[model samples]
Target: MAKKDYYKILNLSRDASQTDVKKSYRRFARKYHPDVNPGDDIAVQRFKEVKEAYEVLSNPHLRDQYDTYGRTDLDSGDVSHGTTYGGADSVEVNNDVFETDVDSDIYEVSTGEDPYSQPGGGPEPGSDLSFELTINFENAVYGAEREINVPTFRICEACSGSGSAPGTKTAECKTCQGTGQVFERDRYSGEMSLVQCKACYGRGKIIQTPCMRCNGNGSFQTYEKILIKIPPGVDNGSRLRIHGKGTPGVRGGPPGDLYIVIKIKDHEIFERHGNEILCEAFITFPQAVFGTEIEVPTLDGTAKMKIPPETQPGTIFRLRGKGIVDMHTGARGDQHVKISIVVPKNLSERQRGLLYKYARTTGEL
Candidate 1:
């Protein structure tokens, strides 16, 4: 393999600060990490490249030596005497690998960079699923509750949430000595660091005899019915929240919420805009010319509406407090019905003759 340029690999300038180099290293590491890529060969190699770049650029003295004298100083060229203690021999090592009094505390622990990757960080909440449920236009105007049969896991009856069998106890966390932390002591920097215990994972205990029902996973797979509440006057995309209705959380955590989105089915005779309702009713030409009583649809039973004499086409009749009710407030909205005159599609011979005679008598076109 060709020797790679660490600076170019990290996309840092020659005069870039140490922090800049570290940030670049972290960015590339997150992208090319083996954990993120799983079985990707190219990503694995790129991960190695990012690690190597950080290994060189993270150290101040090594970066300076590489910048000034190039790669020659990294191998051999010059030697320096450093302090020794406790009968240790005077060892000649590159300043980059040797730590002074002020190195960061993160290097004292394991090589893993991510913080949330401890063993205790397991899957918790169940996923939130969504599906469309349509309600009747009237039912939507009025709130309702329906018992929906949805697929979701509930608490396991066999082992509860503990995973261990009944009458059994869990073992103490051996990795952190029940404190749930790994104490790291660095002789080179003389600083103590604490990290989450990778073994017992801050739980301070472990199950001895695993539950046969849940396989010590502390959760079971099953389906249960849940009731969904639909509020009145809930338009499309109106979301109703149901607490503790989502998937069960892991390790005795509370379950998440399930949101029921409200959608009103289209009414056959009415169209709604906001809280108001609009409908178009067809009337005969005679009905518009002469006053007549007509039955109109409303939330209540059909009611008779009076049409004034000489009523023209495209005239709207307002029915106060007859429209859909406001969901937030109990106030009802008025319904507007526009009347349009209908003309006969096919004219009879007598009708044509009468219309022609009337046009001649009135001198109208």
Candidate 2:
């Protein structure tokens, strides 16, 4: 049978969002489920078809693979193509603009037929995987280039993730009986979680001969080298999105994303309070009294500052454009130099005598 566009089956676009895929599936199911349609075979088939489409494209990884490979094997419950590995084919989104991330555990299980295809069940995508990444403090701050290793259940290239060793047809799931979703009716139990048939792991087909590399799971856990670019000036708890980098979705669904969460390390000498930076500098009594020239530390390097005569301890001197850079506006904040006067621990007799003389002259002897 010629392949059907699973997107149209679910009444969703090929580029529909995850939410849209889910909503479309729910609507399709409501209209076609056997319980709802009451023995309508056409509606039953449509329900299975829409469900298959939702299973794949909703996942980012699966969708990317499907988009790239354009394989119609999913309709026959064939996972014949293993993942074509590469990191440059990744997706990236700017967080400063969107500023949001989502964490979810997605499962893509195919059963019975080509759930998303033009055939009996429809078309479907591939499986999805999930994992977590931890970034460094400085990397989180300046954004960095890094390579990481991850695990995924990619399709089996040998037998094509088909779980079949070679050119063998997989059997339809007996529990769900290729329907993918098993219906349960209990007198007391009002609603149920619509358990995916465990026999096929919710995929309507069973592998006759499993692939050696993936052990019939259709994928392996070998880590791939992935290099990522972190953006500049991302604050702590910020998230960087790498598209098409998540686990492979079903035969045709979209893949998930790699969410890089920024964990900025606190600076030892400087403390950041919003847009401003605060630090303490010790000044001698003469510098405070006579208003002398002092070198102050700022983001742009060292600058000569005029200490006003009679400047007391704890005096704050603002240095324009010297603090932390603003991520949004690109404007800089002023560095607040808080002066602290330190008294010398040891005093010479000559200095003491001079101080006594000056004190007497000042009428404070």
Best by lDDT: 1
What is the Cα-based lDDT of residue 362 in candidate 2? Answer: 93
Q: Give the TM-score of candidate 2.
A: 0.54
Residue 55 in model 2: shift from native, Å?
21
lDDT of 1 by residue, 1-365 (tens): 24467789899855454446767998999999999999999999999988977876665335434442334234432224332210112212122222122211111111112222223435344433444456666656655555565555666667777678878988778877666578878789979977667676555567799888888766766656665545456666554444455567655555644445555678898888877888887788778888788898876767678999899999999999988666444588888888888886688999989878987998886
Error of 2 at 267 (Å): 2.7
